[model samples]
Target: MTEVLLEAQSLKKHFPVTAGFILARTVSSIKAVDGVSFIIRQGETLSLVGESGCGKTTTAKMILLLEDPTMGSILFRGKDLQRLTPAEMKEYRASVQAVFQDPWSSLNPRLRVGSIIGEPLVVNRALPSKAIQEQVRELLLQVGLRPDHDDLYPHEFSGGQRQRIAIARALSLKPALIVLDEPVSALDVSIRAQIMNLLKDLQHQYGLGYLLIAHNLATVRYMSHRVAVMYLGKIVETAQTKQLFSHPQHPYTRALISAALRSRPDTQDEEIVLPGEVPSPLDPPPGCSFHPRCSNALPLCSKTTPVPREQERGHWVACHLAETLTVATRATISAEERP
Candidate 1:
């Protein structure tokens, strides 16, 4: 197996809810990320997928160390994140970079593309201005942009072009892992494939690990080596890209797959629509948080929480009816098309 680049073990982040403004006392906690675990290895992409308020972004935040976990820990290259010293923390930041969802907002509009791309190198390494500009030019070329484009401002570039600039900025640090929080979700449909293909090619070239947070299952299927289905702040299922889509075991996972496949004209399976909105994190349902929305929830599902069971090779499910769940008859999604 490839070396593990980052590992999250039973990670949980709960934000305290305040009741009063006058010396606010903690009323309750919103379980934003409750008991989520996964590993990202070198040269692999692991995507976390779910609907809004499902804790996908929160999980990413915990992994990125933007929010400290209340219950669990994050280990990067075998070093505990929460325990990292000042020097170690700086190293960690350099080793792991991020590309946000909105490239336009991420980039500084006042700065030129060259300065934006080279900012990290200047900040971290304090490289000479001439060297930084040369490196920036090379990065621009790597991302399918003309070197001369660096002279222009952020407003001059199109959405896709701005995203390329954002990507180049992320690449400046030469990080081992990149947290791509909906990297292409903001781009046009025609440009998504280009960005996805660029990301894949970059990973192949550099053996970079990606922790992708995206709601678009098609993008997840195409860019990810493995997929972890999350629901209501917990992971419901995790499996290889092909296996998860074709043989989803958990009801929530199945529903998510069904919804994703609904858009494909060739998909024979109907969308497994769940009833009701996702439960609030402040007061989630007992046992399985997804039980209230699960269409095929068993009586036991509402009474007892299920532990993650390894159903097959590397495939895991946390559901009451996992053993009885059958493989999907629908065709496997093909992700061979690339620019």
Candidate 2:
């Protein structure tokens, strides 16, 4: 079995909604990440997929320690992050890194590529200048960038190159886990594949665990070992990539897959369009939050929240009708989705 690098148990993040600027009071709370739980094992990619504002980003933020969770715990190799000593906290910081959506904003415009890449080393390691420069060059080479490009400013590089630079910086600290928040979404279509391939190669080389946050199903399909589909601050479904793509059990999961499949060439699958807008997090609907948009929602769905069940081996679904839906969706899928 692979080593578990990080684990999150029932993580939740709620933002307070205040009213009356003069005498502000807590009006309500926006449950951004109501209760998310998953684990990333060595060299494995676990993707968290959802529509915008579904709390995937907030979940990522909690993992990165950028925002404190309102409830629940984050553990790094069975150690609770909140209880870490100062030295352990520093070590944790060095072990974890992030690659954000936009490379243009992520990179420092004024700094040369070398400085940007080597900054982590300078902060975390007491290495000499020459050693740091050598390390920077090697990282650039590893990412398919020329060694001499390090002296150039960010503006001189194209978007793809900048993203590669951002990746190099993320790799600088030799992190055990990297949270990729839509890392390739902002790149050109052609460049996206190259970056994704590079990331895959790096993961193999370093045995690095990845927590990928992405909206592109194509990218997710190519990169992830397992995927967790989030809906209204909760994970509605989770399974191995091939299993989820081939046999999604929840209504929302099936809908997402059907939509993605419809876009492929010669695909005849109909898109599942949900009704109504996503309800406000501040005032989420009762029971199953997705019930308002679910076409096959039962009366039980509106009155009682469903507990997540292991509907199949390694496949979990949170829905009142997952069992019935499983039988209905057992038809053969496209060859592309086969394990």
Candidate 3:
């Protein structure tokens, strides 16, 4: 079995909602990530996909130790994160790094590329200044940037180049896992492919695990070994990448897959347009959060939440009627595609 690099067990993050400006009291709480769980293995990629405000970024933050979970535990290499000592914390920080959506915002404007990439090394590891410079040069080469470009500032590089610089910084520490939060969404369509290829190459070269938070199913399909679908701060489905794309059991997953593949000429599955807007996370609807937008919703869906159950080997779905609904959906699509 592959070694699990990181795991979250029923993780939850709830921000307190205050009522007044001065002497405010807790009125309610915004459940950003509620009871989410998954694992990332050594050298494998597990992606989290969902619509905006569905707690993807929040989950990433919690995993990175930027935010503390309100309930449950986060285990990094079998050690609970909240219990880490100061020295262990430093080691943990070096083990996990992140690349954000906007490369320009993440990089320092005033610093040269070499300095930017060397910051992690300077902080985390003790080395001579000369050694850091040599390491920076090698990192630039690894990320496909010219070693000579190290002298250039952030403004001197294009968006994709800046992203490469950011990637170089993340790699400086030789982290075991990297949290990629919308890494390619900000780049152009042409540049996106290059960045994706660079990431794939880096993963292969370094044997790094990735926890990718993305809205683009296409990108997820290309990069992920496993995929987790989040809806209203809860995971609705999870499976191997091919299995989830080919046989999504949740209604929201089906809708999103339909939306993503609708433009492709080879698509045979009929489009699933969901009704109603996503319920506010501040005050989500009762029972299953996706019930409001689900077409095949049952009375049970509105009154009782469903837990994730494995309908097939390693394929989990949270819908109450996953088996029947998925079977019906496949039958309808098959009939529609018949000559």
Q: Name the candidate that leads on TM-score.
A: 3
Per-residue C-alpha lDDT of model 1 across residues 14-56, encoded as one tens digit per residue: 8999988898999899988899999999999999999999999
Local accuracy of candidate 2 as per-residue lDDT tens digits, 213-310: 99888899999999999998999999999999987888888778776654557767767877777788888899999998899988888989888899
Angstrom error of the Cα, residue 240, model 2: value is: 0.1
Identify the leading candidate in terms of lDDT. Answer: 3
Candidate 3 Cα deviation (angstroms), residue 157:
0.5
Off by over 4 Å in 1: 261-266, 327-339
What global local distance difference test value does model 3 have?
0.93
**Candidate 2 worst ten-residue window by lDDT:** 327-336
RMSD of 3: 1.6
**Every model: Cα RMSD to truth:** 4.8, 3.0, 1.6
Q: Where is the poorest 10-residue window by lDDT in model 1?
A: 327-336
Stretches > 4 Å off in candidate 3: 261-263, 266-268, 330-339
User: Model 3 — which ten-residue stretch has the worst lDDT?
Assistant: 261-270
For candidate 1, report its TM-score. Answer: 0.94
Error of model 3, residue 279, in angstroms: 0.6
